[model samples]
Structures are given as C-alpha cells and as structure tokens.
Target: MPLQVAPTFRDALAAARRPLVGMWVCSGSPLVAEICAGSGLDWLLIDAEHSPNGPESLLAQLQAVHGYPVTPMVRPPVGDPVVIKQYLDLGAQNLLIPMVDTAERAAAMVRAVAYPPHGVRGVGSALARASRWNRVPDYLRTARTTLSLYLQIESAEAVENVEAIVSTPGVDGVFVGPADLAASMGVLGEQDHPEVVAAVEHCLRAAKAAGVKAGLNAFAPALARRYLTAGADFVLVGADVQLLARGSERLAAEFIEEVR
Candidate 1:
C-alpha cells in the first residue's frame, strides 16, 4: 500500500490561522507527557535542551503522547544537525530549535531536518519509530511535507536578523524566546522590560511581513495574549515543572495556613 499521509498537527497549525496554545514539558516523565497530551492543548513541547532528556527518554515521551490529539514538538540543546537527526529519527515531526541567531543558522536547521537531494538528514526509518518500523510507507519521501520547523530567536542579534531568518525558505515559523531575549538585552530576568518587549514585537511584525508564522514562550497569560494579539501564531503559556511547583505550593499553603 502507498504511504498513508495523515494530516499532522503542523497541517492543522498552518490552517488554523489562530494562535495555538501550548506548554513546555521539561519533566522528562512519560506520564507527565501523557497527561499534558491528553489536556486538549493544541501542542506540547518535549524539551531536551534544558531537561535531562536523552534519546531514550525522548522516545518514551513520544510514545506516551502518540495517542493524544496534541502535537509534540521537540527541542534539541542546539541547532546541531546530529541532534536534530536523532530527534527526527525518534519521530519528532515538529521541532523548536534554540538559539538561532542568523539566517545562515536557521537555513542550516531547515536542511538538517530534510533528506538527501533536499537536505542531509540520514535515512534510517526502517529501524526507527519515525516510520513505525517501516510501517508508514514512503516516509522518507513524504516526511518533509509533514515536518514543521520553528526556529528560536532568543537574542538581540537574532532580533536584528528576524526578517532574514523568517524569510528563509522552508522555515515554518519563528519563536521569540522572551527570557533569553531579555538576558541578551542585558536585562537578565526582565522579559517584560520595555526594550525586550519592543524587540519581541519587532520580530513578530517582521514575521508577519515575511508571511511566516510567529510564536512566543510567555509564562504570563496576559503577556501571552499580547503576543497572540500582535500576530503570534502559537504561544507556550506554562511548563510542567512550573505547574507542579505552583500547584504543590498552593496546596501546601492552603493546609499549612489552616494549622496556623
């Protein structure tokens, strides 16, 4: 039989034309991934960059979330081709590459995710879950069609080159990382600082003009809405760790205060 090309989350995201809300998964727990996947969010990011997720862990998380409706986007530590290849082979169709600073780097990420004659992704689908152990027919030939590549603009330099980065062919979207952008602007933890906000807005506008999707990772709901209002195609409102911490804290405070 020919490959059954099911419509992926990337397809849904591109067609929605509305901000797709998501959350970060840094817990490296398949259970957490499964829970988040079933939460009805548009997408979920399996973070290998800041978390202790290795290939095995990523595979488990991917499996954990496969049955849900949520799209799982994986982020490697950097935009290294090797790391990207590993994640892709492990069945990550959507990627959120980090620390992209220039058009050249962004272009490299595009190439890294594709196969030969288009890019340099190594072919090993037969041995990988990405092809369902060779069950998803013609995976190598059609994988690029379903792949979504969103580069992170986390620095002042990246903000300056936003136009070029978003205009690079095959880039699905641009993700503005306010936390790192704030640090790069010398404001450290002040993501809402005027300068940082300005930079983020600038990138969003640039992406809009370039006809590419824009995204943001903002913890605050109000700030996330601001980005969506400013034309962000997607936004991450929270993380698994933050949710756990805050919920546990609230629970403890509620009971501990009763004893006092």
Candidate 2:
C-alpha cells in the first residue's frame, strides 16, 4: 500500500464543485513544470501534441510535478493506443486526446486506455511506474477507476457528433479545442470568431446534456471566462512558452523599446 497516494484525477474533478483553471507545459523543462505546478493552478496539461515533448521529456515533467497538489495531465500527439500505452506506463493517469471527431473514435480511445475484458491497454504494470512498480496494490483491477479520459472535440464533424461522443460509456469528459474547431470551421487563426464561439458553446451544452465534465483551451481571459460561464468544468488558460514570450516582450518593451 503506497499510503493511498492521492485521489484519481477523475475523482478529483468529479468532487470539484467549481470550474478548474489549468495551463499548458510546452517548454518540456522539469524545473519549469515544477514551478507551474506549485504556482496554485488547479491542473496542468503536459503537451506532446504541437510541442517538442517526447516520452522522456514527459516523464521528467511528470516526475517534477509529482509532489505538487495539482493534477497533472498528458496530451499525446494523437489518440494512438500504443502512445497511450507508453504514457500510461510512464504514469500518466489523466489524458486529453486530441482530434477525436466521432463517437467511434472516442470509444476507441476509451478502449485504448483500458485493460483486457473491458478495454485494450496492454498490461506491463510490473515494469512501469503507472502502478508504482506494482506497489499500488491490485493495479490492474483498479487502473480504470483512477484514469480520466478527456476526448477533444476539435472539428466541425466532432461538434456535430458531440452528443454521441459524450454519451459514450467510458468518456469521463469532453474538451473543446477552440482553435482547432475554428480551423475546422474554415476560420483558422480566428479562434474567437463568432461561429467558433457558437460551436464551442454547442459542444459545452452537449457535454452538460450528457452529464460529463466539459473542458476547453483558451489563452484569452475573456474567452476562458465566457466558456466557464457556459458550463466548462476545466480550462487551459495559457502555455509556458506563450507566457515566456509575452513576458519577455513586455520586458523588451520596457527596457529597449522605451529608451528608443
């Protein structure tokens, strides 16, 4: 018994009575991740998609944040089962899969994260930190409960099928990717476009209808607050690199541009 460690992310989210605010860890630096983890955020998403993070980098980030009170999540490049398996082995229990556009795909993701007889996650617990090297008693039997699967509704097709996708048996939550949804709706680089906002609201409503947690990614404060007001249970507010870029720009503006 590893002291009951901590509540699963799914359990924690379900227990939360208010919306959770999170950020992206795109820098792939363990020290940076630890800083963010301790900065009082409710959660953190370690991105492998659109970021340079690989398994090793992700492993380090997870280890760095392991002692924090925040829930650490992982977003694989895609929802491939093998990649999911690798992340799970590396001890990622909270997963946000990108580009899931259909109920079928969503169900496949559910299966991919589970073990045999119920789903299809290959068993390697004894060789992995996921079970704390089999230290977390009955790891295989209880793995499903400790896991949270959030499928990203990022396309027009996905938005249309949001109801079915959220209704899938093992889907714990649905995440709306505003930028990708905008691009899918032929409005690339305009995540705040009216049509995209409407679509995101629709997905949020669908998640509420299905009784599953709804999440969104919004770097803009207004947009994040808007989605939160519309029933988003969790939101990714910013990225590490984005923060650094903006902060450095501000410094340069003050120190260099001001003197010019």
Best by lDDT: 2
Pairs that collide in candidate 2 are: none
Q: List the residue pairs that clash in candidate 1.
A: none
Worst 10 residues of 2 by lDDT: 1-10
Quantify all predictions' global Cα lDDT against the true fold.
0.89, 0.91
Question: On a 0 to 1 TM-score scale, where does candidate 1 land against the true structure?
Answer: 0.96
lDDT of 1 by residue, 76-154 (tens): 9988899888888888888899999999998898999999998999999898777877788778898898678999999
What's the TM-score of each model vs. the native?
0.96, 0.97
In terms of TM-score, which candidate is strongest? 2
Give candidate 1's root-mean-square deviation (CA, Å): 1.4
lDDT tens digits by residue: candidate 2, 1-260: 67334566788787898998899999989999999999999999999998889999999999999989899999999899999999999989899999998999999999999999899899999999889898988889998887889999999999999999999999999889988889889989999999999999998898888899898999999999999898889999998999999999999989997688
Model 2 RMSD vs true structure: 1.1
Q: Looking at model 1, report the run of 10 residues with the lowest lDDT sum.
A: 1-10
Candidate 1, superposed: residue stretches over 4 Å from native: 1-6
